[model samples]
Structure formats: structure tokens, C-alpha cells
Target: MNKILRSFTLFTALSAASVGVHAGNYWTASAQDGWIDGYVEATLLLSGNLDASGIDTDVDDGTVTLRGKVETDIDKALAQELALGVDGVIGVENMLTVFSPGDNDDAAKQRKLTDEKVATVVKTRLMVAPNVTSADIDVNSTKGVVVLQGKVKNDAEKQRATEIATKASDVEKVVNKLSVSE
Candidate 1:
């Protein structure tokens, strides 16, 4: 009876361990692509040497595919390198086009500056808004498109936040992903 009981206990433990391992893998595999995409975008956006306004990042099964326009060859390579530096990014397919600005260098620079200014203006407005809780909110802009993320107190606060961002100068659109806290 003792031998039988010990064998049964061991079997149960082994079965549980196997299930845990498989479950962990299943979740990790499913969620990894989205996480990698976000990481790569953040990495490219924060890179001072690269203008990521026109760059689109996509991830599939640990591979990052970069699409869109870059100012120069160096910028294209830098974008790829930044994406590859992200954790869980096993490979990068650089499909970035080198844009020839001709005499439009000044225009290109102005666009980049505008994107930065748009984000700053939106953030400042949120901070001073009486009804909005700006502490938990994050702001990002690219080519006049503003992305608002983070938590808000309620639905009213979320709508108010979006309205504030939309009113900011040079913001062509606002993508609100603010979650209401319970």
C-alpha cells in the first residue's frame, strides 16, 4: 500500500509540472509578438538619431518587419539595429525606403519638430486640465497623430482627455487608449 501511494503521488506531481510548462509556453508564444512590436516601436521612437514618424513596426513569431520611409540610408540601418536590440526580437526585415527630400530638407526637419511639439503641447494641456488625471497618462505623436495611453478615473475623464489632445495644434487625429480604473 505504501509503495502504491508513493507512486501515485509522484505521478500526480509530474503531471502537474508538465501542464504548467505547456501552459506557460502557450501564453508566452501568443503574447510575444504584440510585446515585441510595442518594444520595437518605443525603441525606434526614442532613438535620437532616427525619425520614426513614418516608420511602421510589425512583429511575427519573434521577427520584426520594418516598413515606411527614412531620411537616409543610415537612418534605415539604425532603425533596423534598434528593432533588433529589443528583447525577443530574433530577426529584423528592413523594408524602409530612403526618401529623397531634394530641396525639402527643411520641410522634413520641420515635420519632425512638429511631431515633437504636438506631443509636448498635448501633455501640457492634460497636466493643467481640471477634470483630467494626467499623472497616469502617456502621450506620443507621429506625423500629427497623437496616441494617448494610460489610466483615467472614469469614462468622463477619458473623453475629456481625448478632447484635450484633439484640440492641440497640429494634431491631425487622436488615438485614445486610456483605460478607466475600477
Candidate 2:
């Protein structure tokens, strides 16, 4: 009976230790995943062809997986490359699908190009403006409509951003979604 009791106690202790180890590993993995998600997001945002809001990223043990829809295969490939380039990323599994093919019409292509140009110009204007940190602002353009989404220092900063976006060539509308700092 004593031997049996010793054996059962050993088993219980070992099992508890195993559970603790597993919990520790789980927390470590969770933190790593959060960091990887943020890194992937920043990478996607830095890519000119990719819209970060449209992509979802998951990370497990230094392996980054991308799951989302992009406008073209090139954008998918670019996302994979960007994720792979992250410092701690050991591999990238790209499962992104192209949701829309390129418009075959010349007019549509021109319009898309123009919208991109206008957004870029507006972003540049904000970058050069006094007291405006362009990095805090997100600019997106579609069909000649420029959308500004971000937080600014004050009401003046928000109005300045709107003015800069409005002055961009070919911008038909400015949707200012900027909020003042609290």
C-alpha cells in the first residue's frame, strides 16, 4: 500500500508539472502571435499594392500564414514576400485568393491609376505640411473619392488634413473621418 501511494503521488506531481509547462508555453505562444500579427500588418500597410485592412494574418511558432482576398495575384505574392521578410518569421504560408481580376477596360484602368496617384499626392502633401504627422493618417482613394481615416492633434489638424486631401488633383470628394485627440 505504501508503494502504491508513493507511485500515485509521483504521478500527480508529474501531471501538475506538465500542465504548468503547457500553460507557460501557451502564454509564450500567445505573445509571439500578437507580435507577429502586428509585424505582418505593418508590412502589408507598407506595401503600395496591398490594403492592410483586407488581410488577416496568423502566426504559430514563427510561421506566418496569410488568409484574405486581394485584388490580384501580384498582391498575394507581395504579401507573402513581405511576411517572409519579417525578422522573426521563419516561413510564410500564403493562402490569399484574388477576389477580383484586373479591369480589362482602358478607362477603368486609367481611373484606378488616377485615384492611386491622387491618394499618393495627398499623403505627400500631408507629410510636408507643418505640424502634421502623415504616419498617423491613413489615406485611401477609390473612384476619385479620397478617404482620410485617423486621429489628429486637434480640430485644426483635422481641417488641415481635409484641405490637403481636397487640394489633390482629381479628387472629387473628401471624406474626413479624422477625430481630434482626447
- Alpha-carbon runs more than 4 Å astray in model 2: 100-182
1-182 in candidate 1: lDDT tens per residue?
99999999999999999999999988888698987787678667766667899999888889999999988766776677567655578999999999853333566655765675566557756765799999999999899899999999999999999998887767799999999999
Worst 10 residues of 2 by lDDT: 102-111
Residue 117 Cα positional deviation in candidate 2, in Å, after optimal superposition: 20
lDDT of 2: 0.77
lDDT of 1 at 56: 94
lDDT agreement with native, every candidate: 0.80, 0.77
- The best candidate by TM-score is 2
lDDT of model 2 at residue 55?
86
